[model samples]
Target: MKKLLIASALLAASSIQQAHAWGQTGHRITGAIAEQYLSEEAKAAIAALLPNESLAEASTYADEMRSNPEEFWQKEAGPYHYVTVPKGETYKEHKHAPEQGDAYTALKKFSKIVKDDTAPLSERQRALRFIVHIIGDLHQPLHAGDGTDKGGNDFKLEFFWEKSNLHRVWDSGLLDRRQLSYTEWTEWLSEKITPEQAAKWNTTDPLIYITESATIRDTIYPEGDRLGWDYLYQHLPTAKVRLQEGGVRIAAHLNELFAK
Candidate 1:
């Protein structure tokens, strides 16, 4: 009975991944990697906000909130997970936030809440979970959409034998196939970055991060709708780098938030 319950929960979780930000493992991997680069001060600050949880564990809260019964989580939180940048336009050119805020706008708002000592602790806690998740969201190329394609959600394709869409492929199809737990993936990717690499990738500006993703998104569409081993081979490195940068930048942002 216990095994059946666990399998059922896993099945339910899998169904939701196709429509959301990076699947659970991808977000957790970003969170875990960010854990490695955090300062002692940042870690302590996070502990105060989260009590028993680490940033890695808190990383999926925003996504998980979708399952929540609250109206804000079910409806208003949709736009906070991604931003659409039409082709030939920069985020600045496309700067208007819908009634529902986009990830870039939400990042700016949450950063202030997390850093403000004057804010209610409860509010700050909510903000910090969002801060961790949205950073990972901004790093996924498809999350920075090209306006027309629904971020490639409308682009139908077959990933191996399974019917899927481009957005879902980037969200989890590639990373899930590797079968590494988030911690293992984080450790593996974290080792590949050197001091120089870290310095080059760490940036506080959210817009720059969005731009990097937007540029990559434009270049990554396959000529054919069929994606298999070769397609994964060509783009997997790109995904790894984005994940690496997302982790490093999450740490950088947290360090700045908590710096005394």
Candidate 2:
């Protein structure tokens, strides 16, 4: 038991390395919003896969795995969180996927597992958790990456006088500053999603999410390494849309998966 506790600590410590999608709060918001759109069939299937878990709770599992002692969790999962797209090009235009793996590739891999009825229960459950998280990560602009700066992780700045990076700013800094709980964000975004909007947002293609993120990412850099109200005013809407889209699309993905 002591050894297990020590390993858990190590995993928790490693989670601080990458800001990750919209951070935990953001992912939960996305997950909660997704709950609104899930079909009865999809809901029942998900319950079987994760008897005790909600989609929102499962949505951060991939990020949390960063702390695990397994090499696959520690090393292999890195590329699955983001994909590098060079400046001035789209993901399809660049045709890039890390040799090891990437979000798009990982999505394809895990998604297949989620859909395969023949797969072991344990494997499908793990894949379902990854699918939930990766869909959320896919919507975070930085997760699409612009090969120039480690997805803005390399771009240093002062966000409201606090030393931070462009990636961190987008991940959670702006949302955190608002001081809203994930449930509040979910409630607000959920009301705004009209059926027309949800239909348009629901798609299985990760490239659409990646391309949109990469395009938006290009325009989000702060001019003077100092970001304040002006930055928030201009970009917060985009961030909210991405979060909303993540939730709606995740619901669509699951609906299609279990619709079989």
TM-score of each: 0.90, 0.91
Q: Model 1 RMSD to the real structure?
A: 6.1
lDDT of 2 by residue, 1-260 (tens): 99999999867656445558789999999999999999999999999999989888999888877767788876677788888788888787896676878888998899899888899998899899999898899899988887777788889999999999999999999899899999999988899999899988989888898888888888898789989999998999999999999999999888988885
Using TM-score as the measure, the top candidate is 2
Report model 1's TM-score to 2 decimal places.
0.90
160-242 in candidate 1: lDDT tens per residue? 87999999999999998898888888889999989998999778899998899999999889999889999899998999999
lDDT on C-alpha atoms for all candidate structures: 0.87, 0.88
